[model samples]
Target: MIEKKSITFLYRTYKKHWPLLLLALFGSILESASMAGLAYLIKDVVDDVFVEKSYEKLIVITSVLIGIAVGKQVGFFLKNYLYPVVIYRALREMRAKIYNRILRAKPSVYRKETSGDIISRATTDVERFGEISSTIGTNIITETFTVIGIIGVLLYRDWKMFMIFAFTVPVLAFALQYFGEKRKKYSKRLQESFSQYIQHLNQIVSGIEVVKLFHEKVFFRYFNRINSDLFKRQKKNRFYETVYLSSVEIVAYIATAGIIFYGGIRIIKGEITAGDFFSFLGGVLILVNSLQTLQRGAINLKALTPVVERIKYVLNLPVEDDKGKDFKGLKESIRYKNVTVKIGESVLLKNINLKIKKGEKLGIVGATGSGKSTLVKILPALITEYTGEVLIDNVELRGYSVFSLREKVGMVSQEVFIFNDTLRNNLLIAKPDATDEELIQALKKAKADFVFRLENGLDTVLGEKGSRLSGGERQRISIARIFLKNPDIIIFDEATSALDVETEEYIMEEIGKYFKDKTALIITHRLKLLEITDRIVVMENGKIIEEGTKEELIKKKGVFYRFSVISSS
Candidate 1:
């Protein structure tokens, strides 16, 4: 039995296509009833033309058969035509919904799942779901009616023949149910195996340079292993399909042969006419065809159950708590009181208390894994699963809308992600309504005039992840975006670490001027970048060990002194 929830969800999803659904249903009725009508007309063609020698009635019977043929053709056309519209439309809506849900999901949800798995669910799984949904929708209605009409004709013609065929129903039902569970089991496994294969493929393609340079044979060995597993899994799934279909065929043929033998004996005993025997056999054939179709439909729908569950899991995940009121720019202070962040059994940040006044330029220096990036990430509510209090202007961090909170915060990280789009469009992400002149001015502020040399200037398309641009050029474009955004708080998480010394120096000089009045938090390995900041905080082992003015920290000769000495060396 299909769950009520699944039925409700499917109905709501395609409610707008109900008119097409109705037309398809009407078509199926006409198509199935025509076959039933033909079986009834066979008695006339057999009895009247052969026994009575009635030539006049022959013209009427042929005309009626022609009309039934046309009706069936119209029905076939309607069912086929409406099905694709529903399939593609549902696919488009589902893809859009999944993407939107992914955006609204918390960062931790992404950490738990691989990008390739997510992509497969959105593309491959969604396509399969679409096909199953269309098949279930069309075949369920069409085959049900086809079976009913054919069975009704059989019972009306002769009860004995109907009883003989009905005896096979329980046996076929058990067979279909057993194989359907098997198909469902293998279908889920096949989908999971494909996700793993896609993940490996994505990894190899993205890191092809590394594989070619150092580990070609090792990578190929891994690739071949996954490929072989996929082949075996696919073959196993196909084997079950073949067995299920062949079993249905064998059972149906046995039932048909038994009905013919029994009915022919009755006709010879003079208990029924030749027309009656032939008409009963025709209905039996239609019933077998309808039964096969229904079995296939059932198996397909059962196999898709796991996919529907996967989709439901994603769609039902808790979206970020974005319900709070709008947040204007920061006015007073951002404070963290005894905040701690934990991931599984490991604690990333422990009882880290700190505060940054509005317009304060704070510099943070720490070794890798010291939680420097995680600290600043909390300000924008990007990493929300933490203990203790984070307040913005005396309000709890969760009190402000996440989207509104992010609007006030701008971040430029070491690894800048550039989409495969025009530079103009990339810049537009920060300020969509920015004019070309405004964009150029922001670019100038970030020392990113290199874009002007591109083939189409601002309109030039960057390669995937900005692959065509040099590292410095990509960094500059990212900085230009931040300048255009001009948020109240700016965060630089080793933003210039990827650039050469010359590029870093020039970019930092421009950034120094840009940070004049805005609240800035700079996390850098190069201690020299801390010169423009008002205060510096040194973190080690997820705790702020020392914090003071740069001169004061250098004078203390504590952790800051050792960091400075290492930087100079």
Candidate 2:
């Protein structure tokens, strides 16, 4: 469970207008006062006109009743409309805070958590908070204050009944608060279970191709189990709620019965008139109903505490580590010292040391399962909290902010992804301000000319992740984009591995030309690409085994040369 501080912090992060909440309280008082006044008027009409046979005050009584009605409606309108405005604004503020937290979360956080869990919290959890925020306040404020007002009026009219009612009411509150504890725990579990269900659903949907190929309906058993659990929890919650509601109704019924019996005795003894008893019974219903709603609202407030805490957990997560305050670019080198990248118990890259000079085209080659990708992942400052230092331009990597570090480096992964937009729009992402001539120049540089021959030149809409294009086309577009952006440093994660011999060769020339002086880090199995690179770094078992220029390493026939010879052969 998230701590109390987190929930309180989120609540404080977006404050509601105290004036509005107070106004909601005020409107409720007016509305309840009007209602309570009606009962008094009825008592007066009966006692003064019916029993006393006085017709002179009838016109004044009628006007007073109409005025109460109008005032109640007006009070209701103000409370209903204005209070929701505050609720909506609070919701918007919370959603924004959660989104910013997500944006700045550490990479370690994402690798451990699921996209679906995060998305569910942002969408469903926040929406529930909004609904909770809107309703809980009105119920707690209006119902509670109204009930108090009725009790005060009753106490003034006849202290004995009010005292008895107070004694019984606490028992109902205790029952609700008791049940409320259980509800809060289960509500948290329900959200957690739903998160799990969402996480598993994401895994299944993403791997649907595997499921279909294997024809495995058995794989869906887990989902079935989750659904059953959710159903059971929901039923239990409903049952507990029903018990609380039944108790509240019983309290109302018993109070009514007691009022009838006691008021009748008083009337018979002539201590209180029949007219006052009639008005008292009506007031009793209004007061008890208000208390009932307030009791239920208290339970709901308890139930929503977990959601508020969950939202706060995400919203209050420390914004990702600040990039250093240093302003120097990576003109000299970016060096790593005894760096260890660990994900919880397992380390991805361990005890590594390396450096890349400015204008250095560094090729990082390793066998599959080696930490080649992890090593490059560090340069972009993607994975921090490693064992050692990553320094750029003589300043510690920690000294640079994420904005400064990422702004200077652009990464192109082996897996190509394009937005569902026009080809031109996708390429324009490289340089949003780049001219058409500049864009075409970049496209040609990255060997992306073939895309122009398509029906929509640059305006053509690409389907989801460029599903509209072939694998080679997507790869070329990514390359063209990197070329256009022209960041100071580039990390190519097997960027050319998806291409065939012909496309690879054309891109090899264009890629080398475009990234001539930029600090380039290439993670690839194709060590033969080292021919065009200025330096080569070999990694094995998360350790830097060797480093040298291609020709220099080839003559030695070390690991780089061996892979090179095999790839060539």
Candidate 3:
């Protein structure tokens, strides 16, 4: 049995296309009526042409048969053609909704769900659900109407013969229910296994460089394990599907045989004419074909249960909170009061009190996993779950709209992301209304004038992650976006770590000129970069160990002092 929730969702999804659906429904009725008409006319063909040998009636019968065929073809065309339009439109709507939901989902959701799982639900599972829905709209509805029409003809011709066919329905229904449940179980497992398989494949592709550097045998072994599990689940699912279809067919055949044996006896005894016997048999064959199609559709719908649940899970995920006033600009200092961040049982940031006046350039130095990134992420509303108050211009950070807050803050991180689009479009992401001259000026400020040398200049496609550009060039592109954005607050999270000595110095010179009189935070291990900052903070184990000017920290001989000494050596 299909769950009521799933049925409701599908109905809501399809109800929008009711106009086309009504047309398709009418076509199904016409097609089924034509089929029954064909069976009913078999009596005339046999009785007048064969039994009575009447030539005049033969012409009338042939003409009526051709008309029925034409009507049936028209009905087939309408139903078959229109349902795809409806289904495709519905599927497109579903895909768009899923993508929108994902875009609005909180950052925590991304951490909890793998990209593979998300991609599978958005793509593979949605396509599968669409397939099942198509089957229901086209095959199931049409077959159901066909069965009803044929049953009407069967009862009209001979009630007793119809009774024999009716006896097998209960048994067929039981088989359909049982096998359908079994198939649903295996289908859920199969889908899960496929998700893991896709996840592993995604990991391999994304980390192909690491995989090549590491032991190939280990990666291959893990991949083989996932692949084998996927194969096993798929095999089980197919097994149940095949058994369900075959069971329905067997029952249909047995019922047909019983009808034949009993009808033959009736004809021999003259209780029914040859025309009546043939016509009833024709109806039974049509009914049998219709039921088989209906059974296949039922099985497909059962498989849809898991797919629906997965899609609903994603659709129901909580979106990021976006209710607040628009942040215009920074007026005073930014302050963090006892802020702490935790992921499960592990603390990412300890209680920390900090303050940075407007236009202050603060440098943060820390080893990996020292909460430096997490601390900076809070200003942009990227990390929302913290146990303290963060104030911007004396107002609660959450008081400002996240969109407006992020617009005022610019971040250029170590892992720069470049979309597979033209350089012009990529730059336009920061300032959508920027003109050609504005972009060239921003690129020049970031020391990324290499764009002019490309074959297509700004129009040149950047390829995946700026594959066409070197590491230094990609970093420059990232900085150019910051220049275009012209945010009041700037963050450099190891932004130039990938650059060589000369490029780093040139890029740092430009950044220093740009950072003058702007609030800035720089997170880097390179001590030489600290020369541009008025003060520096050193963190360790999720806590701030020391903070002061470069000379002050060096005189104190603390974490920053040791770091600077090591870099100098």
Best-fitting candidate, measured by TM-score? 3
Candidate 2 runs further than 4 Å off:
1-16, 48-59, 106-125, 174-207, 219-244, 303-309, 320-347, 350-355, 387-395, 399-402, 415-430, 436-474, 551-558, 565-569
lDDT of 3 at 93: 89
Q: Model 3, 1-569: lDDT tens per residue? A: 89998999899889989999999888888899999999998988898899999989999999999999999999998899888889899999888888888988888888789997998899888888888888987899999999989999989999988897789878877887788788878998998999888878888898888889988898889989989999999999999989988987787778778877899899989999889988998988888778767977887887777999998988787887778989887889899999999987889999988999999999999889899999999999888889899999889998999889889999999888899999999999999999999999989987887888999999999998788899888998999999999899999999988887777787788888877879999998887888899999999988999999999999998888888888889
lDDT tens readout by residue for model 1, 334-412:
9999999997787889898899999998999988999999899998887887999998899998899999989989999
lDDT (Cα atoms) of all candidates against the true structure: 0.85, 0.77, 0.89
What lDDT score is found at residue 237 in candidate 2?
Answer: 74
List candidate 1 segments past 4 Å from native. 49-55, 111-125, 175-199, 227-242, 303-305, 321-325
C-alpha RMSD of candidate 3: 2.8
Rank by TM-score, highest first.
Answer: 3, 1, 2
By TM-score, the better pick of 2 and 3 is: 3
lDDT by residue (435-549, candidate 2, tens digit) is 8888888788777768778797778899877877777778888988888888889898988877887778788777787778778888877755666778888888888888888
Clashes of 3: 0
Better of 2 and 3 by lDDT: 3
**Which lDDT value does model 1 have at 429?**
95
